[model samples]
Target: MTEIRVRDLRTADPEDTAAYAAVRRAAVPALLATAASVAYSCEHAHPDARYRALVAEADGEVVGTAQVGIAQDSPEPGQGFLNIYVHPRRCGLGAGSLLARTAEEYLAHEGATALYSWVLDTPRNRAFAARRGYRASRTAHFLRLDLARGGLPPLADPPPGVELRSAADFRDDPRPLFALDAETAADEPGDVTAEFTDYAHWLTETWRHPLLDHELTTVAVVDGEPAAFTLAHTDGASRYASGMTGTARAHRGRGLAKLAKNASLHRARAAGFAEAFTGNDSENGPMVAINQWFGYETYDTEVRHVRTIA
Candidate 1:
């Protein structure tokens, strides 16, 4: 077996992005990753987050990758994340461990007292994390829909006093959508709490992301205010993914989230996307049911794992 060496992503290198995205897409089938999207992430990363993407190479081939960063938006300090992925065919070649060690060292040096990782819910993956002193905390499911054939629900008619619109409609002023997104995100189930208080930061990191399709992201409006929304991401190919689906607190139980998601799914199918994917916290029952109603099936699951740097 060739020795695996880990290093930071080469700056402005398209080849590096391509190699990194390839590993990610192969390891996680439900992810919507493209070289362009990878480059955009590196280019626009916030300084506060201390984002660093590392690739593990073996005989000049990228065999694994890791994304390490601080949760800058979290109200708490010292929160960091490190999600690592190795080529499915190249597991056990030491790439994963090398990448993990490198990421852990960086995060700890950067003042992170704890590290969180998403491990695929498999016997091998769970064992690996356990050996590293990482304990499971929460579970998330990845769902996939065959847009070319999945029996997607018909676009529903908006209920009384509600209007369906796309995120593109608010390109001039997205603050309202930001507010809705922040509120919903704050309520999401997660180990690290994120507060999306920075509007300019949100626009730079999310609204303008390379994979985000403003035209396909459906937003439900009530009395000129955003009630619910479902964001869409595309790989510039026949693949699409739902970035997020959220409904304001006051609008929960009204199925506004489902309404927005349905509209987005229909539009995505019509746009020639062959497949669609999404993820939900295993604890989020309502969203899980909504996705199931739209013909989505759980293709995979990942367990959130945490380890302390004492």
Candidate 2:
């Protein structure tokens, strides 16, 4: 008899991790996820977060997956998150429901008070979350640009004392870039209110990420100091994604983030990437405007939902 069962995503088994990535990609094609990145995330996640990936297996095949964890860097305590997805073809097989209940039980037992998850903007997906007591919070848009023919803006020379650099340039000393990322990320809009204060954590979870394309990531150097950057994540294929685009608080009005993104996109195109993808919070007018200026079209949207678990 075939039955659905939820279990840990075994990082040691390459097949298991690959299946997890497969289901997630099938459910959300806009996302750039790889087996390496999935395993790396589970192996290097911050201990405080209690992070674990769960997969729903039916008939010995993975049909659904979930990312369960607490907000390790959030200022508030007992904040947890669960992101679940089932293979588009395998929906209605009860995998999604089983994953949700199992994930909630884990988070509730871990002292989670506020639980959050992302549900795709579809009637069925919304109804699933609502049945579990989650209310909509915010919406985020995933935008895509045709790198080969989006009419990408031509590269411009940086102003005097401002130069564009690649993330690879900072390999010898990434503390400067880390400092810049921490400053910019803290100011970004979010419900968790997380702080990126731990340098070691950043290096582990961000810098060493499998998808991070150092050569494609552009950094804006102001008088030899890192101030803005556009991080790039590539699937080692044709797909390229903007991991983050941010500028330090001191360099907000200088348009350094836009400058870095332009450089990154140009380089990615040159390297033969066919498509570029990025996501922005619906409320982030400035970022949305920048993405729009890049000729990126809203391809998909996901709504965040939150429920009081305690």
Candidate 3:
């Protein structure tokens, strides 16, 4: 077997982006990723985010990839993340381990006190993480909906005080939607806490992202206020992903999130998207139920793993 070497990805190389996307798609087919999305992320990463992409090469071929970066927006400092994926056919070639080692060393050198990663729940994957000193933390499920075959709930009329609209409606001014996202994100179930305080950053990283489809995204408003929304991201092919669906704290019991998501799903299907994907923490019962209501089924599961630097 040829020796496997891990190195920083040449973000400017199209071949590198294509290879990274290939490994990721082969390793985790349920998630949405493309060469364009990969390149755009690298180009527009936040300055404080300290993001870096790495690839493992063997016999002149890229067999594995990892995304490493700090949770710069988190109120807590020294927290970092590393998600590594190796093409299934290339597993057992030491590419994954080499990539992990290289990523962790760099993050630690950047002053990270703890590192977190998402590992598939399969026995081999879990054991691989455990052997690397990472303990299991939380589990999340990747759900898939067959937009062409599965049934989506019929869109119902909004309540007397509520109305449904597309995200494009807020293009002129998205501050209200930003405010709603910030409030809902604070309550999301996760190991790391993130504070979305910079609207300019959000505008650059999210609103202007290449994959975001504002016309397909749906927002639920109550009395002229953005109460809930479902953000949609697409690959311009037949793949669609629900980036996030959230309801403001004050709008909890109104079922606005479901209303917005249902509208978004219908719009995506109508737009020729054949597959829909979304994820939810195992502990988030409400969101899980909502997805189930939309005919989404669990396609795969991954557990969050954590390791503390001594």
**Residues 17-132 of candidate 1: C-alpha lDDT, one tens digit per residue:** 99999999999989988888898888888889999999999888999999999999999999889999999999988999999999999999999988999999999999999999
User: Top model by lDDT, which number?
Assistant: 1
Shift in Å, residue 190, candidate 2: 1.4
Weakest 10 consecutive residues of candidate 3 by summed lDDT? 29-38
Per-candidate TM-score against the hidden true structure: 0.98, 0.98, 0.98
Q: lDDT per prediction?
A: 0.93, 0.92, 0.92
- Encode model 2's per-residue lDDT on 1-310: one tens digit a residue: 5699999999988999999999888898889888999999999999999998999999889999999999989889999999999999889989989999999999999999999999999999999999989999999989999998778988889988999999999998899989888887788787888688899989999998999999999999998899899999999999999999999888888888889999999999999999999999998888998998889999999999999965
Top-down lDDT ranking: 1, 2, 3
Cα lDDT tens digits, model 3, 1-310, are 5889988888788888888988898999987778888998988888887999999999989999999999998999999999999999989999999989999999999889999999999999999999999999999999999999889989899999999988899999988988988898889999999899999989888888888999998999999999999999998899999999999888898899999999888988998999999999999999998998888999999999999996
Give the clashing residue pairs of candidate 2, or none.
none
Cand. 2 TM to true fold = 0.98
After superposition, the stretches of candidate 3 with alpha carbons farther than 4 Å from their true spots are none
